[model samples]
Target: MKFWQRLFTAFLQRFHLMRFFGRNRSFKELHQSSYAQEISKNLSKRLLNASRTQTNDLLKQFDTHLTGLTEEQAHTQQMTVGLNEVTHEKPLTWWQHLWYCYRNPFNILLSLLALIAFFTDDLTGSTIISVMVILSTLLRYWQEAKSNQAADALKAMVSNTATVLRHQVSAEDLELMHERYGIDTKNQTTHQFEIPIQYLVPGDVILLSAGDMIPADCRILSAKDLFVSQAAMTGESMPVEKFPLQKNLEETSALELDNIVFMGTNIVSGSAQAVVLSTGIQTYFGALAHQCYGY
Candidate 1:
């Protein structure tokens, strides 16, 4: 990087990394926070760069096992990484939605008609029109509020989650995760559980089966004839088969490797347990989405 580029890079990492040190930032709230598309790829490039190793060694780097993170760790990573969803314009309140419905020319004309009726000494006619306008406004507001609520809920739940194994999480991080996300920290045993896509962090051992969405950028650990549909990201209608990588197998980029599974792709056949390395806007599909949608 040139001097200016280096300076700008330092400036960003300072602000971006600071949020993890502060209160948990809302991915829902922060659109540019990840800047996975702009501030240079943080998580994706690491795994891509590290793909020169065997899958086994790759798992070691993330401190993951076949089982998954205890609930605490998953939730903690959720806080750090933000939710896995597209950033949208701030949602409208009930009144705001109502106002939007009423702003049209028809609504304005109707309201004016009601006012004219009132001033013309037609009390019954004015009352009817006023009632109609008020009722319509209330109904419009109710419908819009419900629609927005449903859409918001859907957005929060849209990210396809993954199954992961927990292992070797630190005491401080575990405790912090427990305190922040209310996980079951009492039991010392670490096992597997379903983890949402957005909360995924490096080193999570993710289990995959046929028909499951690959939640993050991952290195294949174990595979049983695993085939994935990369149509959304790669635009290939055919499902591509994959396997665990061995040492000395070189690839210029992680995406070029057969042992890697990317986000937004679906497993078409068999199963696997891969170590998650990159998620959210850090996945291959995320990068594509960022470029196409500018989200």
Candidate 2:
């Protein structure tokens, strides 16, 4: 019975019928599906409680430590969760924008009137109406195109890199380090490296300083006088202070948790180390971006 079930599932998947059956969705399809929003909500629930959990427990939940994840572990997680980058909706092409402008009801009515005038041999009226429609459509298209260009320019100004602690294990010296410390060598061999923010994965220990952007949703492992600006996420003009979780502090909202910081916020003062909790569309900022820009 199990064999037959597997065979039937394979058959449905092979012909791309699994989506109709609500099964066997590919990673991309799963994220793009209607259920994506629900999945993000579930993740949000989990992260909200993370600040109440102890530092050691939180690290254990993600299978990481203050020393950070091993290179192999990072790669595996990256494969499962995808790159830590927000995806924007594709902008309309020039022709598509022109078509959109021409599709306006007023423009359509004017076009129809121009055609009728031509058929009636009113050359002067037809020419004037045709010119009006062309000018209006062209003007709207140009304005929209220029606005898109400005948006693209602003997007380019966002930070694209982050500093993360990653463990490097050399097979040749692994045995020596383990023998000397009587512990795992991987956890003792972490080094801070600047990497592209898109390469970040959950469990990465991020290093933050004043003027640095928060690369992902993360829980503060430790901090010193850390002040972050939440103006990007919340309209609050004042910078909020953050610290490591000392006890199970209760909060009405995730943003109220002093131990957890969200993606896209900026650090205004001090330094800290944090572990990435979620990335890409699973983040609070990412979900908002998805809603605004679409998948």
- The candidate scoring highest on TM-score is 2
Cα error of candidate 2 at position 36, Å = 16
Specify the highest-lDDT model's number: 2
The 10 consecutive residues of candidate 1 with the worst lDDT sum are 24-33
Mind giving the per-residue lDDT tens digits that candidate 2 earns over 173-260? 4554355323455554446655678878899999999999998999998899999998776667999999897344555456667888
Cα deviation of 141, candidate 2, in Å: 4.4
**Which parts of model 2 have CA positions greater than 4 angstroms off?**
1-44, 104-106, 124-128, 135-159, 169-190, 246-248, 291-295
| Model 1, runs deviating above 4 Å | 1-47, 65-79, 83-90, 112-131, 146-161, 168-190, 195-198, 246-256, 287-295
Residue 88, model 2: Cα distance from true site in angstroms? 2.2
Tell me the number of clashing residue pairs for each predicted model.
7, 0
Go through the candidates in order and give the C-alpha RMSD of each one to the true structure. Answer: 10.7, 12.3
Model 1 Cα shift for residue 40 (angstroms)? 9.2
Q: Rate the local accuracy (lDDT) of all candidates.
A: 0.66, 0.78
In Å, residue 54's CA in model 1 sits off its true spot by 3.0
What lDDT tens digits, residue by residue, belong to model 1 across residues 223-279? 998999877655567998888863446554444467778777789999998877766
